[model samples]
Target: DALYVGNALSYRAMAYMDLARMFEFKRTGVAYLDEEAANRGIYGLTVPIVTENTTERESRDNPRAPFYKMYRFIMDDLNLAEACLSDAHAVSAKTDASIGVVYGLKARLWLDMGSRFERYVDDLNTMISHEADEDLNDYDKIGITTANECFARAAEYARKAINEGYSPLSESQWFDPSIGFNTPNNSWLWANIISTNDIAATTGEWQSFVSFQCVEANWGIAVYQDEINYAHGWMIDARLFDKIDEGDWRKTTWIDPEDAGASNAFITKYSRGTNLSYNEWRNYRSYVGIKYHPANGERNTSTIGNAVSIPLMRIEEMFLIEAEATAHTSGVGAGKQLLESFMNTYRMSAGESYTCKAADMEAFTDELFKQKRVEFWGEGIVYWDYRRLELPIERGYPGSNHARQYRFNSYPEHVAPWTNFYIPDRERDLNKGVILNPDPSQAIPLWEGGN
Candidate 1:
């Protein structure tokens, strides 16, 4: 129970830290914006001026907590959790806290925090080196020092989890074809494994929320089928797709064979069997499975078998974070060297030659973005990456861009100036009419207008 709670808290912290790094302006001592520059829009809009009390009421509070505060809170919680779990002894004869789960979690949290706060690079390096030495486990510790060291670390941790008897579902273990929906592999770290009967028994609420079918059924909520297509396609950035080459295994694992006749050719990472009922198969809920259980009336029931062990902190992400931070701190050349080394490890593991050169930082940064996107797709890291890099959110289908634009617009009103959102009316009333209405020109307009 303690370990689970610790892991959960650590995951939350890791997420917040990532956001903090992405949104907060680096404290460069001098403010970059001057009155003239500000008029020219050269310095970019001032970060939205927000105080602790008013921050919560700003337009950007959808996920809850302002960006800066969220990071601080996450860091505090993660630090506390790490401290609590640091000395925890492992109970399994083969696995203990020192050698097993705790170390991986710690290494992950440290690297995540360290990555965002460049000052913590050394601390992260120390943690990685320490964990690699202590745990000879693969998934938890993959490549010691290689070109793809970061990716290797991630792979290593995943490999360790698997090798340590973390079972992924096998073909035979999948549900019967006639029953619809294949049984999830036992190897899942955590998953929302939904049975067909579970869907039929419910009032389609479970199927609607969790399945892609929600797009069609929940059109009133602004959800639609094209939304899924947009999400899948939007995730396919050029940099990441290019890295896969023609026949990489990772690509094969997620990308489906093209169906020329279908409106959308590409499939998704999660595959529902053909035999599954349309209502169950077509919906995201069916694909991801329901988050709640009918029996206990509790959400995220571990017993109902839908609890997917989503890898919150893995060695690969740390490796990338370390590489990026190291490169930023060190010269770009030095960072490229680290990145190349890590990539080579990935190549070797896949029986391919590590072909990247460490000569160009720009190219290397591009590669880093690519690898991170592909490796962490569907794990909820892309949104943060887009924010940190200040990359525009573009989706091919309709409503996708609107959703992202809404998020971006909310940022300025709720947190910082770079964020965009209309000033709240309540604030106008409370602050003696000091609230400034958001400028329409400042909104990071969506990529598409309509579906």
Candidate 2:
């Protein structure tokens, strides 16, 4: 198979996993608190798996597959991908589905499957490899499973990344000033460039979505002295600004709404300052997402247009994955150390460092997810993190200032959502076995008596 086969398999597997997450209930096997609660999770696995080539009519008429059957299909494709992709290929303008990415995908999939499966730990080990080429002079390999070993391996992988001359464009890589999320650095393993050629407004990528969510309507910096057609419609939640910890360099990237005398806090990642030439200043939309910054350099991509790379997998995520898996398997202490090291190195400002030992497993996991949300905000993958755990869809505590659409209403104000998008009607019609999932509550968004 061509290297691309691995990439396609990876993408297909991801699609199924995401659908499974939306349609199936949390799989930690804790036993849903109640039958109603279980129903809210779509306790029945109704989505189908078609292994053979079939038409929409045939596919629609096919029966829904069991949960394991679907995952087994995904794993099958991934295992094949692992065998096909190279041990590691240096990243380029177009990142290949390298063996490392294969491993990273496996780690994520296994984590979604939860504690019953331990194979993902070994998968991570293999992907990082022989201590992830740790010895600057030595190519010997080692396997790790326990927390301590995992921690050491994770650390070494990060270390090897540096030793191999993989430096952040600067110390501010997290809220990267130069690339923000646009630049692919040594830290990036797989990144997909979205040229204006790739831009789709009706069904757009991160750039379009951010333009809708982060930018104010008609907020394009047209007053500036350059030509680029861009606009904004939404803004970042002020509460999210309140969440950034002091001394964390990322906190400085946004203009606080209060200080700015505005109702919403806005991120600098996309805001082109007022009265600045769009060509010289490079800020296009005050409410636009900078993840795929506008690049006029590409042919036909004029000043502040979308011609930037979208990061899919980065070394930063690998560090967190190892830390999380280590905590789950080895113990909180090992995992905690790895996480603290990452924050100290990648997240903190000059002369500022933060460290913690989890009082318990839950505490440690909490910290890991928190770091994930902040670090990966606007990347559009954090929703899966919450869904995998079957956690509530909470924006803020009761009576908080979060916008209404951002906040869900339930008894106690935090339970299942009243609304969830179902499989599109077209899919249901084309795929005969497909059925619609119901809201957790018929009358309200939360379960009966749920708060």
Candidate 3:
């Protein structure tokens, strides 16, 4: 029973973590939506907090939880998980939650919570009255009242996970067609491993084809070669690609124009000997990703290609988190040192060292985030970071690689509110208390700049 309860709590904590990031207000001080949603009074509501203890009647009438309360529940779930779980629990695989995974989530949650500090305080005052369970509702016990405090906890937890002996992958292991991201390595803290019998395998639409360089699959970038079928293939923004230094090992993950030799060789090496013509391969954009190949370097449309492992958490992220949190709690210089150390050790090519050119905190944070974006490309991690930081999305510029229709800038201030998902209509219809987020969906203005 304790084992089941511990696992259930871990899952609940994970789900709540996602919900908090996905639904929390971008900025409580400022409305994320246009004036229309604020006028409609549905601007900043988050998802309803439905805990395991919430009764059916209560669930049907639950109000959207504020940022503080939502996080309170999430922390409580993790706390319960830590208590319920065995210290010696044997975690043979990266898929299962371990003490290190719990620490990783704590680090992530603290950093994310600290990202929207103004909103957290404002929402805390508004929702502080409504209470239920004493143990979970006592926000005072959480001990994080300010962004700096949250950052301290984030660094502390991240350090704990780092002490668990996991290290970042080396250059040779980073894009190894056989073992690179498609399989779990020492760096992975948690992952989702697809097996032959899994639906993702049976359906043959797993991330290996959708986002990875699995040319053997019928879909993804390979769809362009034959011209008979089409599926949306993911690509990197030219602007982001340009930021990657030539010496950085990650530069080879995508089709780099400057490294035409390596790029062409990769296309041929992983092409399953399809021998697509130059024009055929060039039919698609040049910056197509080639990072995630199938397990064991499998090159076919069979289930083997679909049975790829994807990391959900990695030691590399913890290093980033610790660096970021240290910047906030300590000084930018100290954090910059941590970042430079991490990059020099794990990211740079042999004999190359990294240095931070940022003179201040803002520039330093931006530099760190840029490094993270490049490090975790195609990993579905940067979007949440963008949301948390409210960083502008600038997909439109000269020579941009974004699809023509998607080439637009959401910049100079906050990330586009449209990036925040709207509460589902089905949920709204069923629960009277389920307040909705402002529908920020609309055709954005296209950039007039040439691509």
- The residue-by-residue lDDT of candidate 3 on 1-451, one tens digit each, is 7766767778778887888678654532233355545664543456787765789998788778756567777888788777776472447877778878888888988888666663357644443444444645444345554678888999999998899888998877876756677888889988989888987777746344432455434454445535464432456777888887766767766666553334466454434322334454444446666666665666555576678888999899999999999998889999999998998888988877788899888899899999898888788889888887878888788887777777766655465666767778888777888767766665357787875
Query: All models: lDDT?
Result: 0.39, 0.52, 0.71
TM-score of 3: 0.88
* TM-scores, all models, native as reference: 0.47, 0.70, 0.88
lDDT of 1: 0.39
Give the higher-lDDT candidate: 1 or 2: 2
How well is each residue in 106-174 modelled by candidate 1, as lDDT tens digits?
334334433333333443344345443432232133213323344334334433433434332223222
Q: Rank the candidates by TM-score, best first.
A: 3, 2, 1
Relative to the true structure, candidate 2 reaches a TM of: 0.70
Off by over 4 Å in 2: 25-46, 55-57, 115-170, 174-178, 199-210, 213-240, 261-292, 296-304, 396-399, 409-415, 418-420, 440-451
Who is ahead in TM-score, 2 or 3?
A: 3
How many Å off is the CA of 82 in candidate 1?
2.2
